[model samples]
Target: MSFGSFSLCKELQQSLIEQGYTKATAIQQQAIPLVLEQRDLIAIAQTGTGKTASFSLPMLQLLTKGTAATDNHIRALVLTPTRELAAQVGQAILSYSSLTNLSTTAVHGGVRIEPQIAKLQSGVDVLVATPGRLLDLYTQQALSFDKLEILVLDEADRMLDLGFVDDIRHIQKLLPIKRQNLMFSATFTNPIRLLAEDMLNSPATVEISPETSNLEAISQRVHPVDKNRKTELLIHLIKSNSWNQVLIFCRTKHGADNLVTNLEQVGIRGASIHANRTQHARTQVLGGFRDGSIKVLVATDLASRGIDLSRLSCVINLDLPFVAEDYVHRIGRTGRAGHKGLAISLFSDDESKQLKSIEKLIGRTFTQTLVPGFELAIKPIVDESDDDLYGNFEPDPTYLKQTQKRSKHTKSGSNRSRSKRR
Candidate 1:
């Protein structure tokens, strides 16, 4: 539906138009009005679903109509899991609220606290923060939640993954008991529900898609390569297919660096972003990637949740993700905002267990193709016995049969598919 139909504040409607947001996304269409009504909510949606705008657009108006905020006090709070996500959400807040006078600031770890202290000392109507850093600031008396009117937990599942449970609970306890609460998660796992029960007051729920689902616009394929030749295959595909820009996901920071080095050795422009990289370095890499100076951006799961490169069209899993949900997030970097994208995953026979788990979680099997020259050296051993490969993890017969049916469609040929990057 159109933004105008939402009865949004004129300034917000103007911001949406200036931002080229003519129509509200499903999440925005459903959640914005309820949020404006001050109802607690649980939003089940993925990154790049205009999730930031869904809440930011209406929250800006809510804060604008409410009492003016002052230094050291906050009217609204948005908690994210990572520094980059906090910055992205804070940037969204600023961009949407630009036409209004609402002050927005982001606070997170991996940066100095003193500057954030100064920002908070001057007071902010909206504060986007990482849970750990928020707790740190609260302990230092740099910020106060006494005036907090709305508390939003964006990507709440990621916070739990990052061990922010105690911080979330502590922050919950400090908020005004009557304040509004909103929680959004990629997957509403059991733990998230428990936390929601503690936070929400008969909240409304909106589910656009499950974390287990891949974007229909994303063409996903799996390349079966030996563990050692995976890098070579990646290099060959990049050169042969003329991939200008790609986001490569690695399981660890060291692996990300190693892949970048491998790409550089082959004369391909590559950069790496991970937890080990300094925030400055990470920012530089992201900036270059966005500007086309960096052809390949190798990163870990941290970037899976943080990076919001709408123009990125290709995502390569140099290795299978440790968690199935991470696979969804990695591919989510692309195929955003209704744009077509590609997701390539390279796995060896040793990674069969991971692949199986992922297939089960997503309830779909990927079309597995073998790159001609980089084909597997050793085939995975079949479970000859009746016991499950993963003990006690019984396979779903329907899913297993569906996987087998899909695998039969694999066509042996070149691995790379030519497509224009967004």
Candidate 2:
């Protein structure tokens, strides 16, 4: 159905039309009505499902109809997990509120607090902030939530996974118990459900899709290779297949940097994004990747959450994530907004457990192929302790050596001597 079906303000309708969003996504259609009715909501939808606008549109309408609060007292507070998401939601708020005089500001860490304090001091209608920075300001008496009419926890699952549960609970204590509460997340694990039980009061539940499912438009493939040969295979595939505009996911900041270095050495112009880099560096890498100046953009899970790339064609799993649910989010970056995309995973024996978990989460077996000339002669070392169906029992000398070293170090000198003598 079209957004016109909802009784939104003419200004909001006009803004939607200008933004070229005439039809409501499934989540939007289900969520907007419940939100406008002042009911608490628990929304579950996959990434790239237009969940952001579902709450943003209704929130702008509600705040605009109500009286503005005094300085430093925000009427609406949106808490997101990451700075990029906070900025994105803040931007969405501004876009929807552009027709009116409602003021909005984003408060996040990794930047100075003085400017955020200055903005709050002047006054704001809606405040979008990360939990840590918001709490810092709250403790300093730089902002107030006493007048809060609505509390939104965007990406609640990620917030909890990032160990922000205590922070969120503290923030909840600061708000009035009678205010409307909305919790939105891409996945609803058991932990997320328990958190929702605590935060939402008889909330209207909205589920647009099953949990931990990937977009249908994306084609997923796995290439079996040795851990040492993954980089070589990646470069070969990119160069031979002429794949450009690829977003690669690495598990660590150091891995991202090392991957970029390896790609450059192989004549592939690449950039990396991680928490260690300055905000400017991250922005530049993202900008370059979007505009086609950079061939490959390697990043950690932090980059997987909030960066939006409309034309990202390929996503490579340089390192499998420890958490299986994250695999859904990593590949989601490519197949966005109904566009077809490709997700290629380079698997080593060391990651068999992670791969099996991912396969189970997606509810299907992935097609495994070996790239020509890059096939691994040595099998991967799957932990025998894991009961994964896909687990292959292969011995790894490195792991064995480490295990032996640990055992030797743990043994007493008398026991070691007895064993050596025997």
Q: How far is 260's C-alpha from truth in model 1 (Å)?
A: 1.0
Q: Which residue runs does candidate 2 get wrong by more than 4 Å?
A: 211-214, 242-244, 379-422
Cα displacement (angstroms), candidate 1, residue 81, comes to: 0.3
Task: Work out the TM-score per prediction.
Answer: 0.90, 0.87
Give per-residue CA lDDT, model 2, range 229-266, as digits (tens): 99999988888775668889999889899999999987
Scored by lDDT, model 1 comes in at: 0.81
- The ten-residue window of minimal lDDT in model 1 covers 413-422
Backbone clashes in model 2: 1
Query: Model 1 off-target regions past 4 Å?
Result: 210-214, 384-386, 390-422
Every candidate's lDDT: 0.81, 0.80
